[model samples]
Target: MFEEHGPPIEFTAAGDTPEEQTTNLKIVRPSPGFDPASELCAEAIIKDADVTVLDFSPQQVTVRFQIDGLWHAGTPMDREMGDYMLATLKQLAGVDYRERRERQTGNFASLYLKKKQKFKLVSQGIQTGERVALYLDYKRPPLDKPEDLGMRASMGKQLRAIVNDTNMGILMSTAVPGEGYTAVWRGMLEATDRLTRDFFVMEHVGKNEPEVINVYPVEYDSAKGENPMTPMKQLMLKEPDVLAFPDIASGKLLDQIVSHSVTHEMPIFTRIPGKHCLDGLLRLVALKPDVKKLTDRMTAVISMRLIRLLCEDCKIGFQPHPQMIHQLGLPQGRVAELFKPMVYQPGMVDENDVEIEPCSNCSGIGYRGRTGLFELLMFNDELRQALVSNPRLDQLSAVAKRHGHVSMQMEGVVMIAGGRTSVEELQRVLKS
Candidate 1:
């Protein structure tokens, strides 16, 4: 084998080895002293973090973990070791590490604790240095049902009523990306009367979820230029009762769906992305479908956003001033005690002269997990008329308020007052 005065095929190895490689494929040997756990992660960290970040700089790599939408710092790492770790991880994730100036994404899977963990790795260059971020797909528990998604009891009833309707209309579930849009959308699909009614779902081939009981899940080869509509065209030959699919990105498809639902009296369920219920609704309306037809054919929009739950053990309940309550748009005398998180002040010591430890439950972050706040915007005659008369958001919102569509803001206040979450967390989520 010829030694190189040039690059030796860029073979990667762990940073603990200071000696450089002399030939291509020379770093393949793993002996008794090699331990990958130190480079990638520990068993406990794999269970704790929903997202992990390794931000590199000239001097060091700052490690951070995101739990329930909040970032928690991990121990700092040495720069040389961090760079080696990053390069090895990038190669394992199938991303190019040479071009660190450009953004790259790759997928990696690992089996830890007998469960398959899928990670989406994103690495990019920055002005000062480079950074790598990873998201844990399996960290989120399954939102298998309406209650699991944290829907209020009353809102759940209203949604079930919409799903059980015999009349033809469009029922949409909207949430921003990564905000449980799939849960709401698929929950709507699963809530249907699939036993008696022929319910079907269309997704790209091989991307369909596990088959639900009594519901037909179909797929099309998008690589072959066949989509959900392609199979639906042939399926229409049968007496298909209802249809469900994802992605409303295509205007032609939206128009076809609206026209088909109205003309054939078939109900359809789908999802879209936005900040809240009205936000998602208006985005669809902005697509410029027939106002009258959409108003007539659309049944309801169930939209939602997430709110972090305070740690039960560490949350401090305090009396809220009436002025503070009113400032938060809360009704007078409605809330007596409100909860807030306890911040660890530096140099605070216990009776034994030992530094006070942060809350064990939330790791001192004061919030453990998150739950959803939902807005069910049902289109009754008044709301439908309101849409036809004034599709403008303000005019429609005024009418929606009169018809008992509780906005997520109001719902969040309820959650805050109930001690389920804190005012700070509520503000952060709503502002987001």
Candidate 2:
């Protein structure tokens, strides 16, 4: 006889009763002149002990928090229906939240309770306008979080071997209000475990911590004869509109908010999956002045966008017309006339599909999601000189073209010829 087999074991659910999972938390009720959710959202002051509960009339309660620089209110919640929230906040922030009572006109009235603590988990440091607070609604996976926020001073030293050892320094990103720029820069510093603020700036000259300094106004002193371009004076004086943040200088300010996340190491996500991080790194590399050796050594950054191919299912083969070949400037029949002419509808095909069929992948649109297209251009002495001259983007493009480098638009054209994207689509985004 065969032995009876047992079913696979499943995870044990946490709580046994609904009531055990729910809790009542006291929240600071808003006055008539103030917004209720604002207290929990961006720019709101939240102590570790902050909690939310319902009013006596039985209306559902809601809370808001700043997440990635955006303010959002949570789902409507009933009183005593979110014990998990109460417990989670206590564990994460290390504070107990409860309620208090006061005598009103006749009987006792309940209100949010507040108790002072002798200590806090996070140390109180000198506050700066450079710091931004990013809030999260629901916790995201730690592995997918961004970790870099600010630039490190040591990076200039570390890259010495890759560039001119002397006359090389970092340039920081200017603060853009409400973009979470400060928070991103600070978060990056925290990732490297070198987070600090308001120490003597000169003392940390060779260290990793980045300095936050005010941008000095553009000044030309007639009596002193101080030129703003003087290297020594420039180092000592930043433009008034260009507040220098160390984290942004080192390019760490754009790192992901989540610790140890592999995917979200950059602040933004583009449609192209891996292109976001690669683009950011490329931009940082471009910003450096003395890193000519580094720039020359690297190949182009990789980016991908899906494209559509001619639909073989309904395509009809025919010789390409002379006009089409002439416009393309290919010698007559020099380009192999393999797949001639195809159309989506036999009689009603639009001029857009002069020689291609509607694609099954694109459901007769001749395209799908997006095709991956790549453009690689290496920089050298010529390009660096162009950047140093502070030429407009057009001037730089012209110089790059003279060096036999293919423009980003040309790469897109190659993709277009292959039916990956229409010329019209390329026109919409092909920045000069």
TM-score of each: 0.79, 0.30
- In terms of lDDT, model 2 sits at 0.31
List, residue by residue over 3-49, the lDDT tens digit for candidate 1.
22211122233222334322211332232111331334442244357
Model 1 pairs in collision: none
Clashes of each: 0, 32
Give per-residue lDDT, candidate 1, residue 253: 71
User: Which parts of model 2 are misplaced by more than 4 Å?
Assistant: 1-333, 336-361, 416-432
Worst 10 residues of 1 by lDDT: 1-10
Name the lDDT value of residue 373 in candidate 1.
81
